[model samples]
Target: MSDAPSAPHLSRRVWIMIGAAAAIVTLSMGIRQAFGLFLAPLALDMGIDRQTFGLVVAIQNLLFGLAQPFVGALADRRGAGTIAVAGALIYALGLVVAGLASNALGLGLGLGVLTGAAMSGAAFVVVLGAVGKVVPAHKRTLAFGLVTAGGSLGQFLIVPLAQGLIDAFDWRVTLFVLAALVALVIPLALGVAGKPPAANHTDGPALKPALAEAFAHPSFWMLNFGFFVCGFQLAFVGFHLPAYLRDGGLSPSVGATALALIGLFNIAGSWLWGAWGSKRSKKGLLALLYALRGLSMIVFILVPLSPASALVFAAVSGFLWLGTLPLTNGLVAQIYGLRHLSALAGIVFLSHQVGAFLGAWLAGLTFDATGSYMLMWIVSIALALTAAVANLPIKEAPLVRSALPAE
Candidate 1:
């Protein structure tokens, strides 16, 4: 189902599809970001320590990463709309399984594997892939940022509500309620239910050649390496921040508020960053973003813990959070072209998820072993700086076909 060459205008249909994609992302990503708020209650109810819970959470992210490329390809071959709808159903099923489960193993099966795979089909990458296909190259990142911001908006809107629900009913019931809420993404997905635009003559060769070319390129590898840090910082912070704040003698409300602030600020940051990236060097911006994360972590750990500090940290961190996504994804499309954008983006995204797995798992193991999160925080800071350095070498230009040797 190649897209029609109809002079590429943002018509009513395009905006409608964009709105639908954004709505779906709002719930999928928002709920994922809210997982940290459940750690204490889930662990308490299940009689598990942070390490065990962390391992399962880590597994969830790991599975999500592993599944995404394949899922993205499926979305590419089939229609993103169908894949997204299927993902929503699976997401609901996964949540239901998690809610009904009483033990760690059962919860792991639900939350770690089922939910993770569901997210592969339903979450950020899938929606971004769809959004990329519809919008023209010039406006792609801006549109991607809109969907990215939708996820942030979801975090801002849902985390507080989830926290209140958890407070009122309990974790299990809250999850069930969320399951129902996620179902709404299904109808919205209908608007995105079609194929990518047809490949123009300038779009290069088919999938295998494009992939081989991407893999052979040094810039792609560099992109993958830097993206790992994004995953690590985000997953570690998202999953552990609430617990960290609680351990510092803050109330639950404070932790919840901090998370909400992150969501709130990211809504603005994602849009502004992508809008700015349209003109500036994306790689430079990425390096700066990573460096800021390191500095922010240092400041966060050095400063005494309090509501003000937590809120301020959330504001700063949130501004930098998830903003990398549109830039990175857009960069891939810029270098590789949109024909294989979904598959290539999925491959790069896997790096982030790998870091996510390590971040969550290691944070938990370190906490249980030493009863402190300091080691993980230090590791995060070092990785942030390293990623900043790594992004410096990326070349953002499109691949030069004539220069390549015969495949």
Candidate 2:
């Protein structure tokens, strides 16, 4: 099998591009992560129920996942910079629309559709695809991990800022402020402005053949299923945990603090996991992450709900959070090559989003019907174990296509 593209040194331009991509993710993901903070206030103010809010967010996740492949394919053909600029503009518009929305229809259009579509371009898949083409093969996973950490940084910083804004003013004001913050991504997008390097541009299978190859591979499907479990567990906790804490007699501040803690610790987790994957078996590390996450969830619910326990849960779960992205994307690039990476990873990501949709919507439905998230927690645990097993069978060696000419 041929080796993927590799850079001999980390140039100044490379670092700058990585920084810009990470910052874009920081802004886009950071703002999106704090949507849970908006739920209680928005639901009460809009005179809607938890299910309504959940469904809106669910639509957002679904659209975010659904648009990724098309958007990623466009990035591969055109350029990540153009897509990112457009995404930032739409992202800002979505936030403003969401802030002004007085009805569910407006919220769905702004938050669900626009923001979802915007994220497909501005966030991980497109940005990482740009990075993968430039970095040395040995360092690519680490670079991906660093970019993944930006999202954690955003969650830690932005979630608190959002909570404070909501407390000082209102959710509407908070949304507007976040919109202004995310607009910064427009300038940063320029760092990753071109198509793939000449080497990749001149070689590799076309989009159709790439898709056909991935679709025929069993490991690709396994990766998708494992990623689905990741989405299910994360979306359930991120969107619903704050409300759960409130039901257990905790204050809103505690909930916000818990989420911030998750983001804070995940900064370390994402970096370390990415670094580890570079040196070890990416699949083994992924399986372990899922298993540990399941164990953490079980212990958190079994123990009495206290501020201390909640914080501990936040720290542990946060450490496990988002560690999946760097490893998963790295696996795809390692096995399939980078020529069509964005589109391939986007398809895998779509499955994750599907799981996220169910996690958010189902938890809300369960809460409305039974007044507890116990059932969803159980489901998350089962899925985690399944993912752990699912990743074990994947072959890490690159797929060798006989028909395509070697690089």
Candidate 3:
């Protein structure tokens, strides 16, 4: 056999590309997470009920999910930078519009549609897709973990910053400031400039046929279904937890602190899961994480409501938050090659957003009807348990092509 170099050095440009991709994820997710802080203030300013605000946020989550698959496909075909830049512009516009909005329609259009569409383009799938292509196979897991951790850091850093801004200035001013910050992501997107050319092969399956193949896989469906529950649990708490705490007689500072803690702790949790997933059975670990999340929710709901309880819940729940992301994305990359990862992961994320829509909307409905969020908490727990069970049986083997003679 001819000998060739076994390992290659990563260039400075590749490191820069990775950093750019991580920053894009950080800014995009940071802005999205900060939206929760605005829920109460936006509703109060527009003279709308909590349900009205909840509905718009629900619409946002749904639209984000709906847009993701298409965005992912486009990013896979085109360069991620093009999509990232466009998404940054739209995200900035959304924040500005939300700041200027005088009615629910404007809020929905700005905060819901524009921001959601922008997020779809700039989300983790697109970033991870680029990173997967550039980073070596051995280092991909660690790279993805670092990028995901950046996002968690953004959430932790931006929320408290947003809260402080709101305290010092008006929420509208805070939004405009955020819009300006989001605009900076455009230049960062430019750093992910180069992408590999598509391989030319006459025997290769068409994109649609390949997608169909993925759809028929039992493991794919299991992952998709389980991710749906993940979205529901996370979105419900992200959007409503602050409001829930207020209803329980806690202060705004307490709510902000709780959110910050979740973000902060998730940084550690996501990295740990990513490292562990690389070494062990990702599916089994994912199942256990989901089960623990369900148990945590049950305990939080069953216990007495107090500031101390809320903080304890936040600390516990934060450890589980976003830990699912690394494993879920890693599985997608493992089963399918990184070549089609963005599109496949986007489809899975779409299911997640559908659950998010239901979770956010139903929480509002339940609260409006009974003036209590206890029932929704119970529903979240049940969904988590279902997700845990669904994940348990997923086959972790990579897809294999049938043996055939080359044409």
Per-residue CA lDDT of model 3 for 60-150, tens digit only, reads 8899999988898888788789888888899899999989999999988999889888888776878777777777665666567767876
Runs in model 2 deviating more than 4 A are 1-9, 199-203, 403-407
| Minimal lDDT window, size 10, model 1 | 1-10
lDDT of 1 at 181: 88
* Model 2 poorest ten-residue lDDT run: 1-10
Q: 2 or 3: which has the higher lDDT?
A: 2
> Model 1 over residues 131-224: C-alpha lDDT tens digits?
8887878878777777788889999999999999999999999889899989988998887888767665466567788888889999999899
Report model 1's TM-score to 2 decimal places.
0.95
RMSD values, in order shown: 4.5, 3.5, 4.6
Q: State the lDDT at 86 in candidate 1.
A: 92
Best by the TM-score measure: 2
Overall lDDT per candidate, in order of appearance:
0.86, 0.90, 0.82
Q: Enumerate residue pairs that collide in model 2.
A: none
In terms of lDDT, model 3 sits at 0.82
Q: How many clashes in each candidate?
A: 2, 0, 0
lDDT of 2 at 201: 31
- Deviating ranges (above 4 Å) for candidate 3: 1-11, 200-204, 403-407
lDDT of 2 by residue, 339-372 (tens): 8888999999999999999998899999999988
